[model samples]
Target: MAQPLEPAERRPANHGPKVAARNRDALIVAAREIYATHGLDAPLSAIARRAGVGQGVLYRHFPDRTAVAIAVLEENVRQVEQAAAAEDAAFADVLGVLTWHLTESAAFLGLLHANGATGHTEALAHALVLSGRVESALRRLLPEGHRLSAPDGLMLAVAMVSGAVGGPTREVREHRAVAAWRLLGVEVGPVRPFEG
Candidate 1:
């Protein structure tokens, strides 16, 4: 997507920083809700409408839809980081976090998927980072490098949990990841969502 950075001068000079911040925040929020519900194909004008702003205002704030999608994905990353930090959770829970993100992070998914044909490099990066978090957790959960390569096992786990939904559902992928961890010799308990 074409990115247009805001002219640094347009900010602060207008709302003295605080209101500018509010406006930017509002745009991101509006974009998030829209992206979540409608996927990434919702128009900038629609987001502007949701935010009670003009199209020009939306463009002024976000530059383009990819920028908005990036912001949403970034927030998702931040949330995943926070979830990983939760002391109450098990190491295996990172898969849970990742699964939740994949299932629920629709705006990030939709927008990126919509741009799939052109090889949306940015959205692809976002997905990789999100998936990497799970991979890291799986790495720690497993013993050595052995379990990490269990792609077939992972696919089986997906087929079972999601009925082979053919898309990433958190439970399935995370189960597969943990199974790889097991293949690595970690011995994770049976992933509950697939307890059959």
Candidate 2:
């Protein structure tokens, strides 16, 4: 038999920051997909497997499910900010972006709601920040004189859109978006069929 290798030879040296960054990104993407599909109660092992990393890597990056949830929420908020910041973006555009994200993020949203019901302070705070950010973005799209009532209108519109069954069909989303615009006193005609 051949001689056995030393311990240092058997295992490669750690790449340090690069490996950690890769693992962190993988975990975030995997968490978003799994949470979108299976909600927050999905096992940590599932996220690790989906990310092609071990539990140790996941824990090193995020100590618990709440940390993972917060990271996902932060990424989602970043996307909303980017979409809302487009040049001359209108209220309808912001509504459409919010509706699309909220519909796609049903499981995450449900988890937040459940956590809020249980008085999870961090989860509740994150939810408020999300709402406030969206409202602020929408307010920026309104005319100078119409900014005063934007918050109430935005909250109502978000409530109406987010309460739909199965997160609302595409047609229903379009309808609700128009309704939200109307509620905000912005005149928008019915959605026309796509002609291609």
Candidate 3:
């Protein structure tokens, strides 16, 4: 005969804030991988499955694809911020960080452009907020004798990277992004490997 199941109270609590946080984090990671592999328009259900969570969990954390995209962008910005936090961080190093992110996660840039084209203020506003943080960091990172102001530098970097790296493959994108940086007279150093 099979053993009886443990009483409900005897078992550990399975649902709570901790589980919710884990589910949300998993969804973000899965969303990043899925979007990178399948493009931003991939199905949301696929993200849920890839995250090993239910659709309900994903919906609870992120109501829509745009919300998911914004979460990914937030994480990307955090990476850039960390790069800039290094004591000897050079503008080229920071540019390398930005270029790596844009190359690895083109969906972030694509979603930003798409939202801007559609006049979706939430995504654009959030992007601008993140951009301000990066620009503030750039104020310190800007190399002496650099012609562009921090704001202009950040804007140009994003624009050039996005425009130049629209290739169908990762290798092509990285190559183009590097070339774009060179074209702008920025000597981007090696990009740090992504930690997340």
User: RMSD for each model, in Å, please?
Assistant: 10.2, 6.0, 3.6
lDDT of each: 0.55, 0.67, 0.79
By descending TM-score, how would the candidates be arranged? 3, 2, 1
Query: What's the TM-score of every candidate structure?
Result: 0.54, 0.70, 0.82
Q: Write the per-residue lDDT of candidate 1 for residues 1-196, one digit (tens) a residue.
A: 9989778976545444456666676777788767656667777877778876668766776777778777667655566566555665454554455444444554454333444564467776775665455454444443344443465544244223322212344445445455544444434443432111
lDDT (tens digit, per residue) of candidate 2 on 5-35: 8788678687877788888888987987787
Candidate 3 weakest lDDT stretch, 10 residues: 111-120
Each candidate's clash count: 3, 0, 0
Where does candidate 3 stray beyond 4 Å?
1-15, 193-196
Better of 2 and 3 by TM-score: 3
Q: What is the per-residue lDDT of model 3 for residues 93-120, given as tens digits with 9 covering 90 to 100?
A: 8878888878878766765665577545
Candidate 3 matches the true fold with a TM-score of: 0.82
After superposing candidate 2, which stretches have Cα over 4 Å from the reference? 1-13, 143-150, 165-196
